[model samples]
Target: MSTSSIKFYDRFSKLYPIVDVFLRPQKRRLFEEINLLDHGKLLEIGVGNGTHLGLYKKHALIGIDTSKSMLSKAIDYATQEMQLLHMSGEQLEFEDHCFDYIVLSHVIAVVEHPEKMLEECCRVLKKDGSLILLNHFTPNNFLGYIDRAFQLFSPIFHFKSAFYLKDLKALKKIELKEQIHFSRLRYFKLLIYKKP
Candidate 1:
């Protein structure tokens, strides 16, 4: 990530809860996209303010983030069973094939080296594990052109990334389990991939 991006998150972390209130509906859709009880050793990347903590409270989870203020809120929101870490998703500090499930909420796109981060995600995931990614994906048509055009203004928005499934380079080992659209306009998508 760039220095400016880090600074932006640091400053926004203070008001993340309020910001998250507006995202509750999307967050709820993300939670509904997966069946949590079926998995174990869950690792949530970009666990901002731990807004999704309640969903994973009963499961063994480790949530990671780069923002200190966001992590502080995670610590306060987390249960004794949950663990929170101050780290970047691009460089995960975990053993290979250690986690049964890897969860990402609007994270894969914004990171500096999304391909590298996906590689790391694949490395830590067990052979039978599943990867759940929830984010906005370009539609591969006219709307996609608009999303691609937005990349020119990425530094300004600092929220959206022009990430498409076709752009993922280190994903030959996983099979696409499903792709579900979360928005009426078909901008947001939920992708489920499982290692065979």
Candidate 2:
């Protein structure tokens, strides 16, 4: 990760709660269908402020982020089973197939090389494990065109406004199991992939 991107998240850490409110309903809906009770250790990449940490009560949560400022705030939400680490997802320090599930909520588009991070996610995920992704993927319509136009400001926001799933090479290594378009305008997409 770049220093500028880390700095941007450091500044946004305080306001992230308010920003996360808009996506709460979407996240709730997505998590409802998934069964985490039987799962083992859960790793949430880019677990900002740990706002959604409570949802994974059944499993041990290992939340990782690149910003110290964000991790510091997330510490307040930490539980006995939760460990918040200030680390990058692109280079995860874990053995192969260590986790039964992984959550990459709203992370793909932000990282400088999303594909590399995804490869790491797959590397550490056990076979048959689910990789849940929630983000604003580009819609194939007028909204997508507008989204692409807004890419100019991504450097400032530290997120990709025009991110597409096809651009991620690691996707080919896994099978997409489910897709939930919860947003009214279909702006956000929740994808669940199973590593076979």
Candidate 3:
């Protein structure tokens, strides 16, 4: 991540709680997908402000993000049972098959290398564990053209790498047991990928 990007999120951390209200419907679905996991250690990447941490029930939970400012806001909500790591998703610090569930909400789009991140997610997941993702991507229509146009002129404003859309199409090849798209067509997508 660039210094500027880090700064953007640092500033964003302060306003995340208020900003999250607009994302409630999507967040609710994300929580619902997370609830499918029975029990065990859970790892949430890009866990900004740990806003949804309270919704998860787990014996051990670890939240990781590159932004210290974001993690700081989450400190109060995180108990001794939950751990927070200031780290990036591309280079996860965990060992193979370490976590029972991994949540990648709104992360794929912003990552510099989405494939490497997914590879790491797979590496750290226990056998049969799940990877939950929520993201916004180009629609498969005229809206997609608008999305591309926006990407051309407002690349920095969008900040998402082009591969985000490609990854959505490549989910099957990655060995996901299930991939479901939820939400209205153009704006958001929710996916559940269970490792085999």
lDDT of 3 by residue, 30-149 (tens): 777677668788898998888777877654789999889999988888888899999998899889999888888887777666777888888898888778777877767666776676
Model 1: per-residue Cα lDDT over 38-104, one tens digit each: 7579899989888668866345899998877778877878888888998888899999999988888
Regarding lDDT, does 1 or 2 come out ahead? 2
Estimate the lDDT of model 3.
0.76
Off by over 4 Å in 2: none
Name the best candidate (by TM-score).
2
As a whole number from 0 to 100, the lDDT of residue 93 in candidate 2 is: 93
TM-scores for all predictions: 0.90, 0.95, 0.87
User: Over the stretch 55-133, how does candidate 2's per-residue lDDT look in tens digits?
Assistant: 7657778999999999998888888778888889999999999998898888889999998999999999999988988
Instruction: Identify the superior model by lDDT, candidate 1 or candidate 3.
Output: 1
Q: How far out, in Å, is residue 72 in model 2?
A: 0.9
Model 1 ranges off by over 4 Å: 36-39
- Candidate 2, position 125, lDDT: 95
The CA lDDT of each predicted structure is 0.80, 0.87, 0.76
Q: Mind sharing the TM-score for model 3?
A: 0.87
Model 2 TM-score (2 dp): 0.95
